[model samples]
Target chain A: MRLLLVEDEKELSRAIKSMLVLSGYEVIQAFDGEEALALIENNFYDGIISDIMMPKMDGITLLKTIRKKNIDTPVLLLTANGQVEDKVEGLDAGANDYLSKPFAFKELLARVRSMIKHYSPIGENTHISYGSIKLSIATYELAGKESSIMLSNKEGKILSLFLKNPTQIIPFEKLVSFMSCLDAKDKEIELYTSILNNKLDAVNANFKLAKLNKGYKVASL
Target chain B: MSIYGDRLAQLEAIVEKGKTLIQEIINEEVKTSGISPIEHFKYRIKCEESLINKLNLRCLPVTMESIYTNIHDLVGFRIICSYTSGVRTVANKIISNENIDIILSKDYIKHPKPNGYRSLHLIVKLKDSDVPFEIQLRTIAMDSWASLEHQLKYKREIKHKDLIVAELKMCADEMSSTDLTMQAIYDLIKEEN
Candidate 1:
């Protein structure tokens, strides 16, 4: 995914850019909203994260301009202000989500992933839920109420297939069809599934992956 | 003249105004009447990609006229409440409005679909704007059920579509009962206090 991060602080911007790049996203930086708008005119971004306070232009104004141009790119506003009204203003101006300053890095990543998942091309299949565990297919993130962790693309697809057909014993053949790895053996499947199960345990997810007669199924913990 | 631009502006206005009207109603009625009927509300305009995909899928001409006449759900507002009574209450507010005409209403809550889909869908036209849009009133359980059903329906490939549909239909029926039981418990608690 390609993302545009607009922030006035160069140090903070670079830090965020590096973090996003590490997570397999192509990111571009803009110092202010005007620069962001110019960059947008020439380049396309799957999502945008803009600071509400900026030189020459602010995030809210940029949101207005983008919407006025009929570009429905998903925007996540980063604001120093924490009031409900300010958040409401951002949303009313057509922002998809907002994050407060001094947020944890994990929260920022989660919000950015949320924006991307919400605006991704296969928009309908982006987010899926089963009970308390919500999965974002675009971001490869499985989020429970108390915690969340990112998954590899293959793991995400595998978990998603089970969630879609909850309580059903997915046969090995059926599970293999969901994986793109042609030479995926049973041992390799166990490795990926173990990683997913460990993450689920960390998150205290109500569901667990367990072996059925032939394949795996998700059962309540 | 930019007729297309003007139409887009009108649609935005209808969406903004409709949201404000509903919000104001909830603010006033919930405060004075001591009953909070709405859990949450959201509005959306069909994005360009989805619109184009729909036009091609339907084999419709890519013309503004075709869109204006047939794309009744281009602008959608979903109002979710906690109980069935709240659905009727909110729908009545829209129906009784002087400047709004109810083009038609699908009473799915009273008579659910064969697949156990239940929600109240109203197609309405504003008197001054002359644009038709859809408003969906549903309980939270119904909304959740519809979302899951939507996910099931939109898969590009499914090995057993019939089996999935059957399972989803059964889940929807169970959810409807759960909603009724929750509403009853809420009523009992309110009566006690």
Candidate 2:
């Protein structure tokens, strides 16, 4: 998962960023809300954690601004005060959840996980389907009319992406980013695509991955 | 019969009760304000197949306990209003009720989806039940746009998908502008009266 950590306190921000990175998440750090807003405008993150009290703009104002601009990225607000009014204000401004200061890192991680899971479309749905095939996200099984095949984790994730956006070409950059494999080379992605195509053929799936100019899309056979 | 058959029935009952409660609130509001905020409402309980699929997707054990704890939108209500102002008014009244506990509120109307879908979504629990249900409030224009967008979005085959998506977004923006103008005209007529 990719997360943006916005905290004015440099030392605390570093600490949190390091911890999240260690936990297998891509973490981006911004010193204040303005810098964070700039990054937010250009990039997409699974979740954002911002402190309520900041130098340039407070987290509440930052949140309200983003909401007005129709950015629906989930936000978790951090506040020094644990008062009910503060929490109500943050939520009323569009924060998904709130955590007070002096919280355990474990709790923060848990909240982050919950927030991302709740916001993800795949997390809410049981299976994704296109044409005559279905892929069960939980089991990593792709079922065609005649048979079903167990897919590797990477293969399942790749197929899920195509299944979710059937007929629409997913660019290489987006496919890699969505997989959280920023370091993956083009050849590596090509190999995975080929393997996935072979699996589809084995299972007699009605759809196959077709390469476009700079991306791939699921096309009916 | 599946083990969850009884649980599904129970959820349906909860939805029925929630609808009745909301109707009562609307009735009281109309009695005093001389106008109804809600143009119409629709309610549903999640189907058994979907419930099972959701459980499997989350990797949760297929048990009644898991359903109660993990699922929040087993029952849902969609409220359609004639204008944007009516949407807010209806939402305010529903949240003010003592019998409901607001667990989450997402003002998609203020912060719409990137695709331009707009609505105010609330996840709440009735006082008598631990089950949480979702309430969606949107103006007629928004409802119509969202309904059509949802249908087109899930289709497997479409030529010029990007163009269709852009056109839908344009339509949504235009409808929203129209809704605001209609609201402003209504306000002016009310002032004159």
Candidate 3:
């Protein structure tokens, strides 16, 4: 899945992005709230992880703006403070989840997974069969008519996202945002495409991962 | 002798004594209590020195009021941990001693300040020492934001004091969240490990 990680601390952002990439997620990172807002406006993201203390704009303001735009995407607020009032404020401001800083990578992953599962389109089964590809959203398992391979979460989420929005070009930013939910450091859009290509190749699936003018597309070949 | 020289001399003597006291207490804690070497070093030694330097300011009074009211150079230690829960761990550990008097206590994590600052403050008197020192415990993120805010607020125009204050308060709130999230993340990682 693609995700947008909004954070200002360069070292921490880099660390979080690295962790996400290692988990096989495509991530897009923005240093400030304004940048995050612009990315949200220009593309679609499955989730957003934002830091509250930032220059240009703060996380609350960014969340408020994203919500005002009527964007239904799940947002997770990251703050240094774990005050109940702050948590309440974030929730009231439209954050789907909240996490504090100096966090462990595993908890973040769990929270992101929970949030995605909670916000994912209901009635959509984890198991979906289209043409020769049988995708398992829960375990990221993929089985082609002729062969099968364990797809990375990123590869599986990409496929699933495409399955949900067939024929639509998933923008690079959106992919980054979705992938960030699993991990935020892997914002290298190019790397995810390559990884997806490799996974798809291994499964020998009939789906085509294509790069559009500004985004990516999953086409059933 | 100039008043400035006398004050500086007094501060220097107090800092010297404070450092020695901190080291002694750390040694005692290590000998008697369950505390990590890093925590002992950070909470007792480093934080104590930092507080002394911060509090022994030229402006603030050097009398008892400095120890009770001021958080800067007059304070003796400020341990910035990774979580709010850790504050109690440190506090309970420190207050276990029979002689250390807990003169004042504030759990800002449980009840945050109106400005959204989150920290635990303690004023305690050492058994043998007549002077009381201030201790402020917060998450590392909170401490970082607070330090940054202090640096920023003093470096430039004084007109944006209100704006800076609000921003700092917001930052403090964010830091508190980060502390909890980090603890959760750490616990998750630990479980996986």
Leading candidate by lDDT: 2
Where does candidate 3 stray beyond 4 Å?
Answer: A1-221, B1-75, B156-163
Per-candidate TM equals 0.45, 0.45, 0.37
lDDT of 3 by residue, B128-178 (tens): 554556677776675677677667766866776788676666566445544
Instruction: Find the 10 residues in a row with the least total lDDT in model 2 chain A.
Output: A177-186
| DockQ of all predictions against the true structure, Cα-based | 0.01, 0.01, 0.00
Q: Per-residue CA lDDT of candidate 1, range A50-108, in tens?
A: 99889999889999987776456688988785667778999999888988887888898
Off by over 4 Å in 1: A1-221, B1-4
Determine which window of 10 residues in candidate 3 chain B has minimal summed lDDT. Answer: B37-46
**Model 3 C-alpha lDDT per residue in residues A89-127, reported as the tens digit of each score:** 889998989998778999998888888779863125768
Q: What is the TM-score (0 to 1) of candidate 2? A: 0.45
